[model samples]
Target: MTDIETRIEQIAQVIGQFDDAQVPRNIRTSSKEAVEQWLLNKNKEMDLRLGMTASIMDEIFNDSNLPIHFGPMCLQVQTVLETLLNEVRGS
Candidate 1:
């Protein structure tokens, strides 16, 4: 897979591992925005770095106070990325 494709998949996998109830409200919202921005820009290096940072932050901090729909938003972003990857591969 290409670099863009790899980053997309990596972000998707990271997002998939998140537990909605454990994520902070701000992080949830920002994660969705980050995914959307990554989708639009597809800056492989930057996107990969952002995804890795988010994953690290989430692992270090697990907040359950504020509720957010981060899981669903992530799944949506993942689906879009997967679709785009498939299209790029002509599959």
Candidate 2:
């Protein structure tokens, strides 16, 4: 991955460990922002995944009558990420 992506992941990981037990305002808010950005990226990734899944599912379904489809993981992640992004942006 690129340097910027690596840094963002690192920052997100640090945010994962953050708790509001310390400074409940400034540091907490910073950590929250880090997490929100990470979630937004995940949401973008999920869009890509959903498109791929749809194409693959179309091919597979046409080839076989068996029931097969992508799980709801991508949709679930997207929903969570969107909610988090909205919350962050609203803040």
Candidate 3:
């Protein structure tokens, strides 16, 4: 299995590809606005999924008394995503 850092960065890089590739080509200018709105909504949904995942991880951490290092590794993935979302929203 890949280590946490490598796997997270690999996922992030794939998401970057999706950001560029997910949209339909030959969209009308008026419809392009709608597509952009859909992308933003999808991004928000991704954020929510990440939040829920982290919450579940937090529950496990609390119940098991896992290493402090372990909690941050998972949380750091979410933090990286939050930064990406902020940048997408800002743009």
Candidate 4:
């Protein structure tokens, strides 16, 4: 797969880890939607998908009920998405 597609799959895997029952239901549900609805939506442009995913990750990072540990994970995912976005835009 291409670099962009590989990064997306990695992001999806990281999000999948948060799907555990340990996390709040809302966070889990939102993460799932971010992956399934936005990240994996081939109809949308890659840049658009990355932007939307980053937005969702930002929301998750700010969630009151989010575990402290998840904050860094969210940031990492957002950073990767942003980097990919920059590359996509610069090309």
- TM-score of model 2 vs. true structure: 0.29
**Residue 81 lDDT in model 3?**
47
TM for candidate 3 is: 0.34
lDDT of 3 at 10: 53
Tens digit per residue, CA lDDT, model 3, 42-62: 454644543443344344335
Better of 2 and 4 by lDDT: 4
How far off is residue 73 in model 4, in Å?
Answer: 0.5
Model 2 clash count equals 0
List candidate 4 segments past 4 Å from native.
none
Question: Which 10 consecutive residues of model 2 have the lowest summed lDDT?
Answer: 65-74
Question: lDDT per model, in order?
Answer: 0.52, 0.40, 0.40, 0.91
**Positional deviation of residue 38's Cα in model 4 after best superposition, in angstroms:** 0.6
Residue 62 miss distance in model 4 (angstroms): 0.3
Per-residue accuracy of model 1 over 1-91 as CA lDDT, tens digit each:
7776576666656654553657665666655555565433455554354444445335334444434555455445545554554565563
Query: Tens digits of per-residue lDDT for model 4 on 38-81?
Result: 99899999898989989999999999999998889889999998
- TM of each candidate vs. truth: 0.37, 0.29, 0.34, 0.95
Pitting candidate 1 against candidate 4, the one with the higher TM-score is 4
